[model samples]
Target: MSSPVNIPFLSFISLDREAKTPIYLQLAQQLINAIQRGYLVPGAKMPGSRKLSELLSLHRKTVIAAYEDLHHQGWIAIEPNKGAFVMDNKTKMVERPYDALVSLGNYPTQTGYSFKQSNLLDNPFEESNCTYQWNDGLPDVRLTQFNQLSGLYSASLKRKGTAKKMSNNQASIYFKEQLSNYLNSSRGLHISKDNLLITRSTEMSLYIISQLIISAGDVVIVGELGLFTANMIFQSAKANLQTIPVDGQGIDVDALELKLTSTKIKAVYITPHHHYPTTVTLSAKRRVKLLQLAQEYGFVIIEDDYDYDFQYEKSTIMPLASADLNGMVIYTGTFGKSLAPSFSTGFVVAPKNLISEMQKYLGLLDRHGDVIMQQVLGEMIAEGDIHRHLKKSLKVYMERRDNCCELIAKHLGERVKFNKPSGGLGLWLNWQAPISLLQMAKFCTQKGLFIPKNILYQNRNFTAIRLGFGHLTMEEMEKSLEIMGEYLSSLP
Candidate 1:
């Protein structure tokens, strides 16, 4: 006699299920639990759809749908010519009956992406700088040498009488000197106070430039998988987004040629130093080619050097700002990623001819930045403290970066794959296992590690994850990687 096939069971997987939990889910979890408890073993054939449907006294489609859901969640594998079988899950999870849609709105109903208004501001958790536990990747707060900043603030107030009496686009004489030197030495661009304009932030600077240069309906070239918020910002500016695909080296120049047809493009926004989330540094050969293309195409290149200071490679790669002999590149930098000072302080290095008009436009936005901030940061750069801060933080983060790689390697071995960075903060990981990152992140969060999820598109398949280790300690890194590894293994 042949052994009997075991199918999905339920506590009350019935037809009269008008409860909050759906019949399919109630049946799915029970099946998942049965496998968890070893009642259903790997390679053991599932019950025939007809027999199980008859036994459970439910429609055959429901049981089949439940099984399909099981396969979708990586609990079972359905071979082309074979029946469904249990899969190998690295981490073991305790079975629980929970509601996934507790309060969130369903997505299929809302076609395009939409935001929900909430009083999320009222969350009572007193926020300390202790936010390192989440996988959101704590930014290096060591960049905040606040005492020196306080001294700088004092000097700015002393030098400039009041906020209203602050200097024009070139905020302070104190910062102007530093700005000139920084551009000359670091970027190999000789820019004077007449050429540099102080912006409140990089996004604002981009908006100002977009408003000046790009007209509504003008084509704007950006990376296919670019920064989410920045893409939306361009859209808000009324520029038509033309996405250029990126690979290991950087943007596909050949594909860029296809998009270029006269003055169709208003500008090109790029994180050329270290590509956002994707971590691939743009190649020098292509950098030169890109400048040539910009010259030929008559489109400006907006270089956003966010976190360019943390390069662990041979030397800090210069932005196209260095090679901008024709004044087509607009260089923007922020302290948001650099020193962890999350307030207003950003600069835009543009053509000397364009600076005056930009300043005029900036005046319309805000006459000048915070006088105290401008004065103090100027003093820091002038006093050589900024360099010292960068050196110290680089060494600390490099250690954390190496530690993260080691932990991932030791625990995950060869199953999961990732490329170590030549420089910069995060790692882009590609997983061979069949899993959704959104689901994995939720599981990771339940296991006391809150990972941030950015699933841009639902239709696309997920085979990778971006693990940010900048704000984590070596121990936390090791433990998190271990937990991630265990969770991955427990998939089945």
Candidate 2:
């Protein structure tokens, strides 16, 4: 009824007349982006909706709608007497380790390495053919049997027993048993329902593990060239990451012992089944030593079996979890790579002693994952569709892996060195380098080829890059690698 209010805040919000987004959504996205990017900090009050709308020459309803959406997404909150304010610490880093990597120059140069923080991106896998391919990730479409999934989704939602369970805030009992059985058969893990905590993805499991095991200022150890996401997670937990050098077998256990001589290491995370980027299966000998170290040093071991399902040349290697005499290894495995990414189901087999605390902590963030998807996956496995799908995918990925590796051999195997891993997707190439892997990654991009930067650096040089061929056809793989190898030849 009175004159429209004027807002001094939100001065930077400019309405775009030609954008595909609606007026309110455009305003919401801009505000959320600003807050997320640290342009706006927490405890800063937002402009009144009426005032903002009036200033922008829009109706009050429009601005109110935007504010409502932001509140729902946990980006902003409103108190009874107080106006809305940005949520605290959504983008704020709880813990970060800036000192560890910075002090690399001071680290006794056993692992030839200068840590580059920019190499934090995991495999750049998307559904479309738009993004660059990194050798370490699984395909998007290979996540689940979607048609069967859709049917299960509908049935689960409509089924009488499930509705009753959902009404009472519980999941189907049928699913719990099936999930337990699936793990027991698939991974040789005889875990009870209590020991298995289901997560949307392995990343989710690691994040929960971060809360359980890692704390700010805790020391974390990983292979010299580690999985990008794990490195990021450790950093996010505010743990100092010391990269223990990895040789042909696995991470140097002797060096790890020496590095921990004066330090208090809380956790040592390893991808023993198929070490990312390098594709080195951790030797049985090293695995034994690692387990021994965990017991003697009183540190936890997180074994991430990310890609154990895709063995190209031989029998599947027994996972280190099978040898956990002490409940030290926090073992994790995912159906994301071997099956499909969308179905993103993974489990953490923790020590029976730690399971209760882990569940309480897990419940605080996300309780059990979606019941519908869980039930679907459970049924899929019980029906043998999961194993069937995995074997089919293995066939497809193996051919691609061979084609890519063979091409690399044709072009540069004489100069470069790499072990022919009996199983696993992608080739871990070692170019005993005078040429930097980072430099080659840049040149290869210009030539329409995508490869991973050499994740193996001891102190200062990257002599290798992981070249993935799983997603490409034989011809595309050959063409891309041929161009990539030629460019590497041109270097130095």
Candidate 3:
């Protein structure tokens, strides 16, 4: 019979009683360190838990837990009747002292590995040191019912079965159905869930649509003065973007028609409902003409109805997609402007086949959206909470818009020319003076007001500003406009 092996307990194997780390983990880690440092040889037998506990003045269970942890981590192994033994070392090689002295700049740049950045990356907006900011347009988040939304989110979280079902695109079904119903009733569009693809934002929807339809060197039409972000997206897609003049009645379809007669246009992007920067709704005659032209030329109409729910003057016009019969119109909209911008929810309404294709691209871009948020928003829509909220917000915003327009007239007067926008959140003001918009923006900044470069629209023939009123309170609007008025008065 073999004699019983005697295992030595090293003096360094002491535990710190005051340390926050538990005894078992400390012991396990220390043993691992010992093996890595070559102090404990491979396949060396360890003291039995009973003997170790006696030697270390610990409970037998504590020592057993330490050994079990080591065994689980593959640092050591235990035999049936025998004690624990150290396994072979798997630690990484130690770094040399000289390696730490090497500078990051010592490595040479790889040859023939150049990065070509896109021109679209030159962002026009600059961060300013101003207290009051004039945005393009955004919703006031203070009006949102956070308590109710939070409750709904919590309730959805508790429903584990429902959440499990939603893991594989099932969660968006109910929300999409509710959204479809709402859009059909409100926007006069006849669409089902199959025609919709919910996205993270309107930007994402635009990106997906651009990817699907606009190929390299394809001729796409946009308003001469249009949404800059959307134009950037089309440009990034390598499309040859042709610009059509925008007048008081939105994009000039006559110019579009002339272009069509000469060129093979693939798509025409427009903001029909309260156009961007200008806020001019395309006239009814122009709408019909544009739709007919789309049929005649076989070009797709991409209509972005960003702030359709905030109309205060006449009844809102139905989207171009509502009147599209030839399947040439693709309508995209967002709830961000209607609700809080942070609660982003945008959707695209198109032919079923196009929607199916958009979903494939959407999957590649984003595998899933916020399921709980969608579920909560769907409930709000079904219960009419969203409609009620919109109604309340419309009343408040109408008052704000009126106040802002009146203030603009009182302060800036005839120096700035503007038409009171009937439906949108901004008033498109054209600078009648020969002052440079870049200089005016700088003057405003000096007076503690920030007007982003992107919001200050300027081309060779036009100079304008889209002063948004939705997000500002009456007091803020008054203060900001007063500063702007002072700057304009001081300008030569």
Candidate 4:
């Protein structure tokens, strides 16, 4: 056998005593790296542990443990009288030349192969470490009843028969049954477990629906000012998107009707409870007209009632899905906006046949459904915890909405035009003053408040923003609004 390469172990193999990794493990990993990188070739003898430890200023036992580890992992071999030797790993590759600048552990920056890219699916979520931030109508996660939820989750884990249920890949049937009853009582949705497909988010539900129903070049329709994320999902699925006008009431059914006469549409995605960004409730007349058109034209209506629970008014309209008689509507929405985001559940209420098809796609995406969370949610719905939570949260959110509107009106004044929406976490402010929305966002960020670009809608026709106040406290809201007010007033 050839002697060990005269390569200096100290030159390439480094040890950081202060690192969290154990010294022995770190030494072993570095030795493995040296072997894989051809600094130490196969069948080369290793120096005795005592000599190596003395050279590296480590205890001899530490060096012995590292060698033992390498031997256990089959990277090296040891015999009674003989020392360790590098084993042939059998991975064929050209020996890489040593470079001082090269790092053995650095991950590759790009893929070796080409991939299809869709600009439409570009990330709308921005990363920010700022203390103050705005979002597109999200719940205040701090208000979640985590103690009760965690207790329920913990109890479920210790239950007698939970292991049997978790061993299988099937979704939580008991939870679905409970959720089905909850929807019937709350949303007027006459759905059963067979008609429901649980998902992590409304976006995931929409993606599954798009994959199952939409083909390349299929026509999908939305309002002129629609949900940006939903439009991204449709366009990414290769749908030919057609937009109709949205007025104070909602999407123009008359325009939709005219378009239906000339072209065939596969689906119409609408947030009718309170139209996204603009926050306008669909008129009852238009809702009926839209449903009638769906039945007449054989098109699907994807009704997203994202914030149905927080409506402050005495009178509220049931979702378009409630009145859907011919199976023309595919209703999807979140169940627990009052709870923390991790506890929120998304459900789709459609005909049983359609739901069955969606299940196959869901299985492919999420093989292991979160059964514990489902159990907790199911118990919450059945035990009236969800109802009480929603009732309590609605009062708080209503007050926030009122306070937010008052601030906007007092601070923004005549510079902006807006209507206090009946229900929703956000206020849509149309900036009448001549100022760039992008510039306002940048200025706000400089002042330690981050405003995401997705919430800023600017064009030649109108400049507006969807300001979310649900996550902020009364004090935070006041301070944030004051900052925004100052920025607008200071601008020419």
Candidate 5:
């Protein structure tokens, strides 16, 4: 038999009596580690239980238990008198240094293999620790009625029928039916549960749709100033993106019509209810013209009415999908936009055939959907909690919108120009002064405000900003805008 290898076992085999793990199991694991690392070679004689116990200052019975565990696990063998021996692993040991062997247990910082990367799909959102922040039109989560939602969710959990159905991995059929009815009543979307596919977010809906429609090098059109994340998705799918002009009345239908005469366009993406970054609603005439053009040109229209629920002006305009008789439109929006951050709950409204196909792709992407969250939201709709919540929240948001517009007009004076958007949570500010937006963002950051770069649109022709006021209180909005005004005043 080979002699026991001279390894400093104390260097690596550490024990903590305070830890929840029992001492015997920890010792057994550490011994296995030593054997695998070649510090204890095959056929080597291990120190006797009593001898090792004295060397390590542990009870003999603890060492004996560890040895018995190793023996049962096949890592070692024990004889009546010879004691424990390391078992042969059938492979030659490399016998690396102690420090090198310890380092090898750590995870690699980067991949060892090469792969493709797409700069087009890089994340544009940034994280910061600043005192204040801005986003591109998101609802204020603080205003959400979370207590009511939590009660609803708790009730759902206690229901035996829901628990049994969920255990079998069934989709939330009730939520789909309730959501479909809500959309039909609110958005004028003529659809049933079969025409809907619930998604984690509108971004996920856009991605799944892009994959099904856009082939490599296919022509996809958008406004010259479009939603940045949506553009990234289309480009990542290898679509040849083309941009038409957007003005005060939304996307220039004439420019789009002119482009259609020459190119075989695959689809056109729009935030028609309130154009992203600009907040201009597509005019009634343009809506009719655009629908006519879609039929004539045979292209898909992706309408993202993200903030349709928060309109403060005269009754909100119905989405284009409401009047989509020929089924040329695919409408997407969030169902829980007014609720707390727990649910992102986005739904896509399309023809039943297309929805059936999208469901397959959705299954591949999000195999296990959030059934519990859906159940809670469905309950909210059924009990009219959603309608009540929106009605109560709308008044508060309207006040904030009015206060934000007044502050901008009063403090900034002639330095900035904007329209009080009729519906969405944000206002589009067109900077009139000659100031670099990047430099202004840096200046704001210095004064404890974090203006995300994605919200700032700057190029040679124009400098614009989409300042979201919905997420901030009146006091916060005042402070943020004051800092912004101070920076603009100091600029030449």
Candidate 6:
């Protein structure tokens, strides 16, 4: 037999025995790299597996396995008796130079072309590694009945006609019907399936609503301190947002009246259940006036009752959609915070005309939501599992809220001032001390606690923090508060 072709390039191939990657895979990858870099020219006859294995001090089977892999990937061709040869077209290999083929020991900084990011996504924060994290009004997912939910999901997947039924959108109809009944009974909403549109989450619902009503330069009113995410959605839609001051009684309706008189307002978004970031419930009188203004000025009222089921002190207030006589209210809510944010489901209740339009937009954004999940959640709602879960979660969360409040009082003392929110899962602690919120957050993080950048609110007129207590255990809450208190006390 003719002497096998001696490949000088084999001298450069090396393998790390301790590496978690298998030796065969390492050999295969190096050979593939050599082919891509043009070091092994196409049609070049390769050394016999036995000879190559002896030269590299590797088992013959290892070399054979690598060769088989390359052949499978079309990088090389195996002859009946001769041996292996490189394929003529190296296009199968990813483009890279021989020198660049060397491992860089870490992720590459840049690939061929780079593009600039939009200014809208500026000032992104890095992910935190702190052991203790304080979320923003999220539920304790640990308490969720996952076993039951899994059973429901499994049962749904096994249904004989599930695939065919979902294709026709029949699954969503059941969800809508169940959701309609639940809302009517729980939130005093008077609505049927025709007026309801289910969405993936509350954010999706807001985006759809913005698309339906907001146009370029259309005046949309929001509170001075509002949901930042929702504001981003409206701004993305090119709506001219007008911010009215929010006080102890929610958005200043009188100021809203002045804006309405001058400009043709398209929509006003309000979280009446518990104003985001502040946790102040909209007063009854303001709710009445706001509805009246919507009727008089011909603007749609986008009422977001995000956490209506978590009221601890008194009876929950009914949504504005319940008493909306002029059909001017577009109500949006989410079951995310009810059990766990991961299990989030959003729905909108509005006039039939608007609901139909919103569904058209929804179809474009998402043809249909999780059909199996929808069916599972529908069954949960119909069987009172959701209600019972809420009731049990409400009790647990209330205790946690109180525990958090006591810890803040004990640790922060006179340095922090906050009112016990009647409902909701967060506390808006107005810092009475002369310390920068950014500084305080950094100090807490150094001590193994994570406070997100968005929670640290500091502008010319506002200086406070919204601490969420729902997701944390009592022990974690206490430790986090102690760290926070120590930092504040150390401040001048």
Winner by TM-score: 4
RMSD of each: 20.8, 11.9, 8.0, 2.8, 3.1, 4.5
TM-scores, all models, native as reference = 0.69, 0.71, 0.79, 0.91, 0.89, 0.81
Question: Once model 5 is optimally superposed onto the true structure by TM-score, how far is the C-alpha of residue 342 displaced, in angstroms?
Answer: 1.3
TM-score-superior candidate, 1 or 3: 3
User: Per-prediction count of colliding residue pairs?
Assistant: 9, 13, 0, 0, 0, 0
* Model 3: CA > 4 A from native: 1-100, 103-113
* Best of the candidates, lDDT: 4
- Candidate 2 ranges with C-alpha deviation above 4 Å: 1-134, 140-145, 168-173, 259-261, 436-439, 451-459, 489-492
Instruction: Give candidate 6 misplaced runs (Cα > 4 Å).
Output: 1-111, 114-116, 122-132, 155-168, 215-218, 261-264, 295-298, 360-368, 473-475
* Full-model lDDT for every candidate: 0.71, 0.71, 0.83, 0.86, 0.86, 0.84
Q: Specify the poorest-scoring 10-residue window by lDDT in model 1.
A: 98-107
Indicate the residue-level lDDT of 270 in model 3: 93
Per-residue alpha-carbon lDDT of model 6 for 371-484, expressed as tens digits?
988888888998889989888988999999899989999998987789898888899988774578888788989999998987778877658888989989999998999998
State the weakest 10-residue window (summed lDDT) of model 2: 96-105
Q: Model 6 misses residue 67 by how many Å?
A: 4.6
Which candidate model has the greater TM-score, 2 or 5? 5
Q: Write the per-residue lDDT of candidate 1 for residues 1-492, one digit (tens) a residue.
A: 113232234332333377687776767776776666555565556666677778877788988898899999988888876666667454443333332312111124554776854442233222223223533234667556777666666666776455544644344666766877876887787788777878878777887787788788988888977766567678777788888888998878778877785447778889888787677888998899999988987888989886677788777788888888888899887753556555337788887778778888888888755766766677677888777877887888888888888888898788778788876777877666556667766666667766655521233454766677887888777777777777778878
Clash total of candidate 4: 0
lDDT of 5: 0.86
lDDT of candidate 4 over 175-195, digit per residue (tens): 899999988887887888899
Ordering by TM-score: 4, 5, 6, 3, 2, 1
Per-residue error (Å), model 3, residue 425: 1.0
